[model samples]
Structure formats: C-alpha cells, structure tokens
Target: MNVTGWQRDALLAVAEVVVLAVILVMALLGNGLVLVVLLRRRRHHNPLHLFMLNLCLADLVVALFQVLPQLVWDAKGRFPGPDFLCRLVKYLQVLGMFASSYMIVAMTVDRHYAICCPLQAHRSGATQRWNTFILLAWGLSLLLSLPQVFIFSRSEVAPGVYECWGNFAESWGLKAYVTWMTLAVFILPVVIITVCQPGPAASSAFCCPLPKAPTARGGEVSAAMSKTVRMTLVIVLVYSLCWAPFFSVQLWAAWDPDPPQNGAVFTLLMLLASLNSCTNPWIYSAFSSIQLYGKLINILCLVCLIQTLYFILYM
Candidate 1:
C-alpha cells in the first residue's frame, strides 16, 4: 500500500509519544532517586555528585519543557508556535543539550581525578579544586549559549514547528548560533575528548606502579581505576553514539528541508536520534549499579528502548 509521508509520520509520532511517556516515568523515578540520594548525604559530598544531580534535573526539564511540548505539537499536526514561543522552545532545547554535554565532560574529569590520581584525589584539598572546575563547566555552557537565544525564533514557513538552530552557512540570522554550537558542542568538545583520551592511560602508567614493590592496596587501586576508566569510556561512547547520528541527520535535514521525505530511512534516522534522551539514564546505570535499584531501572529502561524501537523497525 502506498503511504504518504504524513501518514507514516503520524504513525511514528504516536510511537514517539508512547516512548516519551515511558521515558518520562522512568526518568522521573531515576532522577528523583538521584535527588534523594544526593540530598540525603551531607557528609560525603563531592563536586561530581553535585554535577550529576544537576544533570538529572536538567534532563528532567528537557523532557517536561521541550519534549512534551514537541509531542503535543506532533499530535496536533501543527507547529502551533508564535515567534517568541518558538524562541523560548529553542532556548529550552539548547540549554538542555548544552548542559547535558558539559555534565558528561565534568563527570569524565571527576573519574580522571579519582581513578588516575588517587593521591591527588585525596591530597591538598584536591576535591575542592575540582568543585571549582565543575562551577566553571556550568558557567561556560551558559555563556556559550547566550548569543543563540537572540538569533533563535520560529519560522512562518510550512505547517510544521520549526525552531531556528545554528546557521552552518552564511545565513546571518542563523550564523551566530551555528558558529557557537559548532565550536562548543561539536568541534571543541570532540577534539578535547579525543586528545584527553591518552590522559587515563598515562595516569595508569604512572599510578599502577610495578610489581617489584607490591603494596597491599595497589591491586585494589588498580581495579578501581580500571572500572573507572571503563565507565568514563562508556560515557563518551554513549554520548557519541546518540549525538553523532543526530547531528548528521540534522545537518542534512537543514541542507535539504525535505530529508524525511527522502525516504523512510531518513525518517527512521530522526526517530532513532531522538531516542538518545531516553537512553541517557540507562547508560549511567549500566555498570554503575551500586544498588539493586540500578539493576531494576536499567532493565526497565532497556525494555522501554526495545519496545520504542519496535514500531519503527518492524513497521
């Protein structure tokens, strides 16, 4: 049977709603637990933990403020946005995305310090130093996104919700956003992630210490560092897995406004790309499951992902 793009999109949008609903429930529980856990402990506070709490909260806002509204728009089959409203949507989205990325970087740094430099992690008020760095992360993300707020608004084009993002080319209205987003979100972060990759290895080389003088705690430290390394690597990998396809698909869509019309494949790509937001909590819980709570939530999140992907893959 021949199906129109709108027809297919309608089906997919329904599926998206289902998935978003499931994710909202899980994220609320998972992030709510995060808030409880972080807030409960006053004695063992650390900067990384604080950042994670903020991360969960930010992700929660995104689901509520941006995702829910977009879903409503999709259901109504209309953009339903005035220009100022569009700008507000754009701001919420950009802020959420930037905050998430920066939080990942911050978490990686925390792991780097804790596992790689155990002595430094403890010595000379090192924890406080990293806390300052975390503040800088929040600050930089906010500062970087300031220019895009003014440039982002709704377009009066087709009958779909269109919020302005960065202009990759010479579109002046979109230029400032394009420049900053490219540098901060894509270019600089990826480059820094790649270059700093060697840091953990180098730290291990120095910290592992030869068996010629084995201390009792040496093995324990090595194992801890190893797990920490694996965790950080997964964090980066997950970030890339989710965002790369999105950026690629989005770039193409911007160049060719009819990308979803190019075929079901492009539409599929968009569907899969949006799944990342729903996937973040899972990634965090994957190996970091310290309690039975993590195990249950991880499994539940996985089931949600599989079910969410079913309509797209099977249909």
Candidate 2:
C-alpha cells in the first residue's frame, strides 16, 4: 500500500516525537544524576567539580527549556501559546546553549590551570574563582542571547497556527549571526579545549606532587591520571564531532540560500547535537569508580549505539 503524503508526514512527525521523548528523558535524568551526586559530595567541591556541577545545571536547563518545548511543539504541530512565550522559548533556548558551551570552556580553562600551573592553581582560591566564573558564564550567556528576544517573534505557520523562528531584519544578517555563533560558541571552544589538553607527565606531576615518592602507588596514580586525560580528550573529540555537523549544516545554509535536498541528514545532525548534552554525563560515568553508574553507562551506551546505527540505516 502506498502511503499518502499527509500520512507520511504524520508518521515522520510521530517518529520525531518518540525520539525526542527518549532524548528528553535521558538528558533530564543523566544531568540530574550528576547534579545530585556532586551536590551530595559538597565536601569535594573543587573548582573542577564545581564547574562540572554547573555544566549539569546548564544541561538540565537545556533539556527542560529547549528540548522539552520542541517535543511539545512537535506533538502539537504548532508553537503553542502567546507571542511572549514564543519569544521566551527562543530566548531561553539560545541562553541554555550559550551557557552550556561557556561552562565547558570554563572547565577546560580550570583543568588547564590545575594541570599546567598547579602552584598558582593552589594559591588562587579556586572555589571562589569558579563561583565567580559561573556567575560570569550565566551573565555572558544571557547577554549573548538577548538578541533572540528582538529577532524572534511568533510567525504564522498555517491560517491559525503559529511558530517561533528567527525573524532577522535581513537574510544576510541571519547568516552572519549564524556564522559568528557557530564559530564563537562551538568551534572556538573546541580549539581551546584541544590546547588545554594536559600532558600525562604534567598531569602526573601535578597529581602526585612527590617526584621521588614510592614507585608503585605513584605509578598507579600516574596511570589513573593518564587515563583521565585520555578520557577527557575522547570526550572533547566526541563533543566536536557531534556538534560540527550541525554547525556545518548551518554554515551551508548561510552560504547557500536553499535547504539541502537531504532533509533527513539535517535532522540527524540536529539529533546528534542534542545527544551531546546527554552523552557527557555518560562519559563522566565511564571514568568514575562507581560500579552501578558504570553499569548504567554501559547500558546507555548500548542504547545510543543501537540508535545511532538505526539513524545511519534510516538516512
């Protein structure tokens, strides 16, 4: 039986709803778990952990304010509510995205200082500095996202249906903004993260201060530090890969005034970007000692792998 055009659209929409629901659930729970674990261990509030906690908070905000609304909007087939809410959704989503990106940059900076300049890191009162940086992250994110408030308004989708999308003064203006945002928010951060990669020797030296100490325990500590560095490197690499496609697609759209012929590819890129928010917690769990969390991470990894394979086949 041949599927009618509207029927195919409805089925595709339903599939999006299902996938988005799964993403929403994982993002909320995974990030919430990180927050709970960190907050419970308040005594271990080093600057790195503090920044990580903020990352969790920022991811949760994205899951709630950004992805959740998209899920609802998908199900309802329109941007539900008043003009104010449409603008608010657009604004908050951009804010969450900026906050998440900036927090990662802060973490990279904090880690760089800790590993590369331990003496200065020890003297700087990290807890206080990180707190200030967290505040700054939020402030900067809010400021950066302020343009969304002015650029986005409710536009008619159908006769009675409305949706929120960027309403820039000119196409070139929107393209310019996309290009700038993609570079500043995503590409630049990845470059900074790569530069901040702590060498094994430096990390070992910073972690195990006594250079001439017992070889066995020191070796183990050094090994663990090296493993952590490797894990962090992989996490950053994954982050870059996951986000690069989405930004590249946006850049293409900016240059070529037409949408790509392969719409599914664009959707898949977006899904991968959303998946990044959920994947970070699992990446953390993979490097953690908690057996239960590690098991959960393995299970989640399997699920994600299966989904990824399905996405590949579907595309």
Candidate with the greatest TM-score versus the true structure: 2
Tell me how far the alpha carbon of residue 34 in candidate 1 is from the true structure, in angstroms, after superposition. Answer: 2.9
lDDT of 2 by residue, 252-305 (tens): 877886876346556656656777778778777777643437555877899999
Worst 10 residues of 2 by lDDT: 205-214
Report the lDDT of model 1 for residue 117: 55
Alpha-carbon runs more than 4 Å astray in model 2: 1-3, 157-160, 200-224, 291-315
Per-candidate count of clashing residue pairs (backbone under 3 Å) = 1, 0
By TM-score, how accurate is candidate 2?
0.82
Q: Model 1 segments beyond 4 Å from truth?
A: 1-5, 46-48, 81-83, 114-124, 158-183, 198-201, 204-216, 256-262, 271-274, 292-315
Over 36-127, each residue of candidate 1 has an lDDT whose tens digit, in order, gives 66667646765545666677766776666666766766567555767777667767766667777777677766665565555656774766
Clashing pairs in 2: none
